[model samples]
Target: MTQISINGVQRQVDADPDTPLLWVLRDELQLTGTKYGCGAGLCGACTVHIDGQATRSCLTPVSAVGARKVTTIEAVDQGQSARVGQAVQAAWVKLDVAQCGYCQSGQIMSAVTLLSRNRKPTDADIDAAMGGNICRCATYVRIRAAIHEAAKALA
Candidate 1:
């Protein structure tokens, strides 16, 4: 058994030390909000905060987490950067950004992180920061627009 603090609570999960945190979070803990895209970490769908940094959970082993703070979208919505997320979510609803809605969570996660770090991110910054996330529906235009809208509100 290994102990990991998810969001804020400490929980012990019985699994391989090499098991990816993504599996531990979704399978054992049943936090399905984090999605699996490319298991290799190319996609940002599994992005979560590890010790306050956005990390790709798909490539991170549970054993490596140690005492780091892990925050997902569920808890990120209430985090210090939550207002940015709320603004982004609102903009998403207003712009109808989600095509299939599968990638929106990851997109929102990345956006919240970006907005948290860069209060006024430029188009290049948004592109560079959000480049890892893939939206199969090709909703990039609306996504960018929504980010701009959300940034306006957040700023």
Candidate 2:
């Protein structure tokens, strides 16, 4: 059994060590917020925070996780204590960042990570941090706007 700290809870998962963390999260843990996109890790749809760094869960092995804290979109708000995440979420909603919404979870996760590192990210910084996440709806404009808005809110 492989044990992992998901969100903030420790759970034992009975799966192959080589199984992708994405499957473990979606299939076993039922934390479906992290979507599977470009199973090769090219897309950021499966983005999650592995020890506070935005990681592509689809290509990460369950065994590799070890003792790292896995933060998903479901717990992005940190149960109301995540100021950065809440601000990003609020900005997303306020700016209407989502069109189809399939990629919003990953987008939000990446945005939160970016804001955590750089409280005042410029357009280039936002683009660099979010370049991997693809929104089929082409909502890049709103996404960038929301990131700027979130950064201002955080400031």
Best by TM-score: 2
Tens-digit lDDT string for candidate 1 (111-140): 888888888888999999899998898999
Q: What local lDDT score does residue 7 receive in model 1, on the 0 to 100 scale?
A: 78
Tell me the spans in candidate 2 whose CA falls farther than 4 Å from its real position: 79-81
In order of appearance, the predictions have TM-scores of 0.94, 0.97
**Candidate 2 has which clashing residue pairs, if any?**
none
Q: Model 1 clash tally?
A: 0
The stretch of ten residues in a row with the least summed lDDT in candidate 2 is: 73-82
lDDT scores of the candidates, listed in order: 0.87, 0.93
Every model's Cα RMSD, please?
1.3, 1.3
Residue 130 error for model 1, in Å?
A: 0.4
